[model samples]
Target: MDVIVETRYGKVLGREEEGVRTFLGIPYARAPQGERRFLPPEPVEPWTGVLDARAYGPICPQVANPLNPVDGFAQSEDCLRLCVYAPAEGTGHPVMVWIHGGAYVFGSGQSPWYDGRAFARDGVVLVTLNYRLGPLGFLHLAHLGGEAYASSGNAGILDQIAALTFVRDTIEAFGGDPNRVTVAGESAGAWSVGTLLVTEAARGLFQQAILQSGIPFQYRTPESAEWFTAQLLDALGLSPSSWRRLFDVPAADLVSAAARIPARDGLNLRPVLDGVTLTQSFWDALRDGHAAHVPTLAGSNREELMLWVARESEWRALSDEERIARVDRMWGPLTDRARDYYVDGRTGDELLTWLVRFASMRTFTYPTIRAAEIQSEYAPVYLYRFDYRPSRLGAAHALEIPFVFGTYAHPSARALIGERPTHADVSDAMHAAWVAFVRSGSPQAPNLPEWPTYDPKRRSTLIFDEAPRVEDDPDSAERELWSDMTSLSM
Candidate 1:
């Protein structure tokens, strides 16, 4: 079965699968190639004939990795596309728009693990989109000014706003309600949602947002971002006189140049604090009740830092004194608290995993707490802590994606989580909670524990463990430790 819908960019034929109709590689904007590399996305021209959107689009150009086996895939610059999945017999179902995460440097909406079929099964329309990344998506060239470069260092986020506007203007033709939309994401995507929540440009586009493993703390200052952009040009052998040379350089060269650029001391290449598109930090806006009306769902996993700590063989070579010293430096004054909870008296590999987990919790816990505090004033906020450990990796980063999407048979799913049913029920509960939230503002579901909205009084949280339960203020000890340290609210 097929459904042909007329979009502003002309007609598109969507293919029907078993239970859902899917449209893939639908262009929301014109390709940002050549002269338009660092510029804002342009409106896609209307096509006279029907566009066959049966296949997934190409992923954005990214740096390839040798040690990390998964990064070895075909990538390109012509990747500003979107994929949509909705019920075949749809009328007015709620919608969920997903944004993938890879530290704002890599990741695409085209990954098989992000398949929205399960979301459609859960009675929601799911849309995943791809936008520019790396230098093309986030560089702040000092010369470009005006609305053409108004978004500048934050082109990736502007691309998202454009995609949401497209959805707001056109999704009704596909049998989904525009007003009942929920935007959700993990890691950098979660941070992007945080950014969207505070922006005046994103007003009324989404009713609810889910931030998984991230909050407002993950941002770079504008001055720093501009400095990094200048360094990139210098490394490419282009004089300041030839700043415009970046526009003509081959896309492959730009992507390759990204690989050679060293990590900014300790900073990641991400959405920067350009004063135009993003005037104030997300924390500033959330603190001043800017996002008071927006409902939010925020949380971090139990073993969130295992992957970052164990990505390479760096930990193996460190001596005991050096290792423990490194841990102390990472945790600083919080080392005592982390040692008390995670390490206790553990040593060697056990201690390493414990410290990694503590570090991740330290980084994310405060931000999530702050976000909850600010948003709870106007709307219900759902808070959670994923503590389900699947084998040695524990409950590492991105472990919850497949579970929430209910794609147990995906190849990457099997790779990330081994064949185990120990945590399957937890996934079912979480996915159900997500679907219920989209259906209405409340996340209450039948047969599940009564999930409470976050409040300063109870500091209530949904504890997702072997036996899922609602706990009153699970992170009180840690929250108290960071009270004085919290300079910003969200």
Candidate 2:
């Protein structure tokens, strides 16, 4: 029997399996197509009949390789949907709204890695959503298109705000508590959560946040956004005057063109720091008390760059000269300082391994700590360093997703964890911490170690290894390397 629920917008049908009531592919906003392609999302109108929401919805337009699109959904521009996983036995459970990460290029709520059954079974209403990506979702048309397109650059983040609005207004019907919502994500999704912290429009939509391996680095400023916009327009062969042609061109063209525009680190076409949508100081937003009411759990993995850099043959084959030059660029005058600290100078896998460590920290880890230090002043914040190595990749980016969701047995996760044996104990502890945070404001899981709130002086961070434990200021020597530099972006 189909379970029917009436939301404020309309009645929808969902499926129930294994003690979880899952309502998939529910539209949060009208199809962002035609004139609305680059505009902010518009609310979905109320439908008269019961809507079929058993199947997952189409994901935003991107290059979805038919063989293995991680989102595991069809592609289209009319994609502004979310999936809700509510416990079969609950009426007022705390909500965890998960945002799937793909460097703002791909992935959707239907990502197999983001299965929410664990959260549902543990008495939390889990919501995962899809947002715009690449040129269609993030291209900056405001400067060329004028005031009408002022927000065109930030349409993706706006899509997220719209999804949060949907949750706030309608989550009650699905057995969730609107006032007790936690907005959580990993990687770009985690960056999006951090972005939402400063997004004035997104204020009060969520009460707590969980950022797992959220690379805290470069965000697109207006100047940078315009440069990216220029590149995309050129890729499409559209003159400045003919920018309007974007509406008529096929999304596939946009996707293909976006792939050609190389972005070594983040400024490809993700969320822009449009003064209208995002504030200037992204990290300071937490310190300034924009989200004083919200507590936070923020952390990065042990070797964040390894997962991405390991597969790139070009990166693997860098000469010592080229390697030193790249490090110089990343650290500037601090290059010698970094060289002295790194100490490992042999080439091949050894140098690359050490380089990965330096890049991950220089690019991601330091910024994360600085952000946490700022946020810790106003509200309670818990820090963590995920040290569980899944395969030789060594606890890299997105490795914690399956563990956080407790989807340990998923095929993709199996492939990622590989034949070297999986760790259910790590997954269980990590997943429980997430659940505990969602239910209460703290991540003090019953089975896990005592997790104290973070303070700048001590910098207590829970290490999620085979033996999960809390330590004060892990690797302080490496962290202090970037101390003099007030601002850092990879």
The Cα local distance difference test for each model comes to 0.78, 0.83
**Alpha-carbon RMSD of each model:** 2.5, 2.2
Which residue pairs overlap in candidate 2's backbone?
Answer: none
lDDT of 2 by residue, 240-259 (tens): 88988989989988888887
Q: Model 1, range 90-134, lDDT digits (tens) per residue?
A: 678898899988877778887777888888877899999998888
The all-Cα superposition gives candidate 2 an RMSD in Å to the true structure of 2.2
- Candidate 2 is scored at a TM of 0.95
Checking candidate 1 for backbone clashes, the offending pairs are: none
lDDT of 1: 0.78
Off by over 4 Å in 1: 66-74, 143-147, 324-347, 486-490
